[model samples]
Target: MEEREITIVKGKRSTPFSRGILAQTLSQAGAKPELAHRIASEVRAELLAEQRYTVEEEEVLARVRDKLIKKDALVVERLDKWRILRESTEPIVVLIGGATGVGTSTLAADVARRLNIQSVIGTDSIREVLRHAISPDLVPALHKSSYAIKPEDIRIPVKEENTTLYGFRIQASQVAVGVEAIVDRGLKEGTNLVIEGVHLVPEIILDRYRDHPNVCSLVVYLSDEAAHRSRFYIRALGTAMRRPAEEYIAHFGEIRQIHDYIVESARRMGVHTVENFSIENSSDAAVEIVANRVSGIAEKAARRPSSLLLDASARGG
Candidate 1:
């Protein structure tokens, strides 16, 4: 039997059928790799068997969705949500918050990969920028730790019952101003972003974005303090800078206090949360959470009329 290939038709233009695009759509819909590949291959065979030399782009998607629906109903739902994300007019913003050792950076990097969003910013980076902008002598709060902070140095109020906690909140507040500015730019430019770091506390950062349809926010924690400490050891080896295991352990009390504050605030804000025992599961959970929040805007985006050939160059033909 001679083999055949299908070209996807878009308006007046056409391109070869891309198995990669079908497989990616399936994977984004939460299908396991083996399953997504199997479905994509199956869909390709079915369409080509129809003997159509050229196929409409919508028809291509329909065939892929039909195969997915037969395999698992939930995947079809996920596909629709994934489609919404792809077709959205507004850029998606994912905010991940946690204390120093809780894997916020790891989770953000992974989620950014899954979502295909190019911009990922750490709040620490934001802080560093602010530091260069202002003098440490003037804004001492910007120069120091949330715990053991000298009130006179940073202008933190000593009268607060928990000055350590108050100081941490103040530090987060300073960094969040920069966070919001970056987020606003992404939103205005329609570029998806993933932002993670300690300073992204719920009250300071998550609360403002929670009500936005284009935003997905999560706070992660290490339920086991001992396990949390171990992450620094593994992290130090991966990066150029040595992890400050001793400094962090010495101030574990302050860090833990900030962790508790974030968890409590996330609870109140009704944002999604992850416990960082397993990075794989935590990353998966974040994708699902982001999908749920972005679903509302998907259909509206999908209904939009377009003349561009969005799938003409999807991976391989």
Candidate 2:
């Protein structure tokens, strides 16, 4: 027998319920993989058993919330926070940074997916574009790898800072101009974006937008040197040796030095830092951090007086 399709009514539109999408949403809201799928299956089964041909989206949400609240209240809270973020009209901007081999690109993609952000750019891409526009002689730092910066790469040096960090900083600052321009365009155009790269030293880009509720920034690092070293091999293998592990390994000391500098900067600036132990654990932490930041903004907006709220809304705050 052909099964009856369950339709979910949202506003004036209706569509068939999807267990996969529901489960993915649950997972994005901090549910475990197994638990999210199980909950999705259970919700579908319950709806079918009840013979509900058509149900409001609110009913579906209530059912899911009931299931999650009984199992994990925190997950339910995350669900609500995500809902607030999703419903907000403001553009969300996520900035992720890490030294080489720390998986910032991977985590940035994961976080962007979970947040339903459509635009993802890398600082490396920004640097590449800048390289074409400007000459290496004019900006020598832009031509070198962030981890393997030499004294010659930096045209000017900062007093007291080591040549390595100073060169990295100079390169990063040059790229920061492009990064900030992209960020400004995103904010003006109201586009959600996730930008990640080695050059996104939290202090440079993050500090400027730290007070903005819709903006979130964090750094990812691998604390264990062995694990950090092994990731280059794993990454190389995954890429079919397009990015050879040996080259990165040869400069591993310099890469690790840059890693330490970024981590130290993050700590000193009170920025969020996620240790890249495992993707699942780190993704969860990253999502939670975003939820916390956005939720605070939503909550503060809620508490504001109506007149003040209207004024803030008019000013696009």
**Predicted candidate 2 versus true structure: per-residue lDDT over 273-294, tens digit per residue:** 9998999889889988988887
Q: What's the lDDT of the predicted structure labeled candidate 1?
A: 0.78
Where model 2 places Cα greater than 4 Å from the true spot, the runs are: 156-161, 298-317
- The residue-level lDDT of candidate 2 at 97 comes to 90
In model 1, state the lDDT of residue 10: 69
lDDT of 1 by residue, 233-270 (tens): 67776776554667777888888888888899899988
Residues forming the 10-long window of minimal summed lDDT in candidate 1: 308-317
Every candidate's CA RMSD = 3.8, 5.8
True-vs-predicted CA distance for residue 89, candidate 1, Å: 1.2
Q: How close is candidate 2 to the true structure, as a TM-score?
A: 0.91
Against the hidden reference, what TM-scores do the models get? 0.83, 0.91
